[model samples]
Target: MTRIFPRPLTAAFAATAALSLAACAYNETLGRNQFLIVDDAALTQQSDAAWAEALRTQPTSRDAAANERVRRVGGRIVQAAGLTNRSWDYAVFVSNSPNAFVLPSGKIGVTTGLLGLVRNDDQLAAVLGHEVGHVVARHAAERYSTTALSSVAISGVQSVAGDYAKAAGAIGGLGAQLGVLLPFSRNHELEADRLGVDYMQRAGYRPSESIALWRIMAGQRQGSTPEFASTHPSDASRIAALEQYIASQGWS
Candidate 1:
């Protein structure tokens, strides 16, 4: 039996395959190979939209001091991360649950609850550093690229045949949900935690405070999802990792 693919589809597949191969680039910063098919422009646009939507739908804090504090601290972290290329924006969302998020577009959203939770500037720096680390590490971009590539491959295969039911492309990629708020992989969280401490240390903040912040978070989430089942790493595991990394760097 002979199977034939349309010439256009064949050409498309060949071109995409070549592009994918070319996109497998080594990021010295991350010390890993990344498959990046989507360009930055698309990511920036999506991120901007997400930021805007969040602001529109959510209630923002009218507290000027809170906004200033986030901007002041976030600026230091950004500078320390050597990501001063773009203008960064900060917003204070009025919520009781302590939370913060960063967008690749350099926009940051922090709940007023988070501001109240931080005991000192160093603790605040730790949180900002972690978010900034995610940006510098390009974790969101990497995740998006992985999901996009998986989807393309799956769609391409599905377009082909009924005979190839055995072709399993389902790796459970998050389809089209490109929000910045999505929880990163456990490895991503750990890497971000490491990078967060690095930035805060360089920014003249105490790196040990990073561990302290995680401890506080752990205390607050006393009985949440189990570590194995959660998207983010367990707070204890994260604190231990941060402690080890900070000690290894000889930074408090």
Candidate 2:
């Protein structure tokens, strides 16, 4: 009879022990207990790299006046968002995708396609406020941290199994699981919407413009989904959440 070995069991236990210690170490460094594992500096570096690559491939707006308008509104929103510690760089992309994003390192991009959707400075401020809220709340960092934790968990599993093929298959399965996390992404969108209204109001822009902006977006989405839907709240859901937030806060 073949002798049975405890290598896999021992390795599994060891991996679990290491992960526990790592969690403790991460908490110490963050100065608080956090459910997500993350390295802020590493996430910032990754964000910067991704942003740089995007800028290189994407076309930027050449219309000087339009660019200026976006910058002006974006500047006010950034300031009002109180993210002075972050190095903010705002740009107008020449895409017709009607989308916008705020990167982890405070890089803001607004597509020219969204210009027509914004009726005035206040409406534009509403959009900018929403984008800036993502940066302020460190949503990107949270997402990255979740991804890192998953990678760590996979690594631990692989160490115990000692089967590279199995590990690869497991990773593919996990990737699919992560892909289904779109609702979590949507939750981030709602949080940003609530914070955006408050930021716009504090900046002296009528928070009501946010509702109007969403109306315009909803109208545009009647034919098909907006590009913003990939990373934003649905129009009706966003408008309702914003209204609820405004009502709760008693902000006029």
Estimated TM-score per prediction?
Answer: 0.82, 0.75
Model 1, stretches more than 4 Å misplaced?
A: 1-20, 156-184
Model 2: per-residue Cα lDDT over 193-233, one tens digit each: 87788789888898888888889888876465553435556
Model 2 scores worst on lDDT over the 10 consecutive residues at 25-34
lDDT, each prediction: 0.81, 0.73
The backbone clash count of each candidate, in order, is 0, 0
Give the least accurate 10-residue stretch of model 1, judged by summed lDDT: 172-181
What would you estimate as the lDDT of candidate 1? 0.81
By lDDT, who's the top model here?
1
- Pairs clashing in candidate 1? none
What tens-digit string does per-residue lDDT give for candidate 1 at 1-252?
Answer: 998887655765786688689889787877888777766656898999999999999999988888888999999999999999998999999998999998988899999889988999999999999999989888778787766665665566556545663453332233322222134477788888888888898899999998888888887874877765567877778888998898999987
